[model samples]
Target: MQTFFIGFFGLAAVVFAVGVFRTSSMMRSALALLFSQTALGALFLAMQAEFLGVLQIMMMATEMSIMAIFMVMFMMDPGGLGGMDMSHQKRLSLLAGLGGVVLVTGIAAYTQWEGLASATEAAAADEQIRQLGRELLGRSMLVFETAGITILTAMIAATAVAVKVPEQGGSHES
Candidate 1:
């Protein structure tokens, strides 16, 4: 049952990932990415990584929404109404992608999984969650804070760009 769900979500993630690249529309691409990330989160949940799954879903939802907003604001044709091609360097990109897949597959195949901690050595769910909270809010707090500030800055910039200023010559004050 678990394996089935993992496989299902994994396949869905791959399909949506392909959709992200295959679509020419910026809005569609962003939506595809959101679906892909959500599928990955579901895969994590199927694998029993509750915290990671929830975090992935929440973070990607917010990130992708912001991305879509920025795209709509900044892009000349965010919906791809012009039907322009979005991809570039096809041959090189294909080779690089293939190489990455082969390398990752080799690594996964060669790694010794038995050396990792067994179920007996594994911490309980509540304890693991507490440790994760401490780890994130402790040493990793600065990184999260920086990311938050950066996102806020970007949102402000996007808003500024989207705003339409009055023409200097057209609007004369008395």
Candidate 2:
């Protein structure tokens, strides 16, 4: 079962990577990235790292959905799936992305880490999960509330920028 789960995750990751690279539409790329993150989360779960997996799903899914919606709302010809206009900005963006990939790959290659000898032998695993949940819901309540407020503010700001208010009454121009 574990091997099957791993294989499934690996296939999902490859498909998402192809989508990210081959898609011309920015929205499609974003969706692909979301799927990639989701697959990674599932992989973590399959490896018995539940907490990180849940966090990955929550944050990446929410962020990608929000960005995709906003892009569709704000971009011209949102439905058009044309190739991206590769300008100097796009070139720069690609270079930055490449640099980030190299950096992360390097870090991963250099890191020396060992996995738990026995997953079942971990002390207080259940208690640790409970503690984490308590901390997130209790001590981190304010942080979560603030994040909601920030999202609300961003929505209002986007609306203000995109929506034009009509004049209250017709006025004669000089």
Model 2 lDDT per residue over 15-93, tens place: 8976876665778878899999999899978766778788899999999999889878877755445655534576788
lDDT of 1: 0.91
Q: What overall lDDT goes with each candidate model?
A: 0.91, 0.80
| Candidate 2 clash pair list | none
Candidate 1 stretches with Cα past 4 Å from truth are 117-125, 134-174
**Superposed model 2: Cα runs more than 4 Å off:** 1-11, 25-31, 49-95, 112-130, 167-170
lDDT of 1 by residue, 1-174 (tens): 988999999999999999998877999999999999999999988887788899999999999999999999999999998988867899999999999999999999999977974664446567879988898899999998899999999999989997998667655753
**TM-scores for candidates 1 onward, in order:** 0.73, 0.56
> Model 1, 28: alpha-carbon shift in Å?
0.7
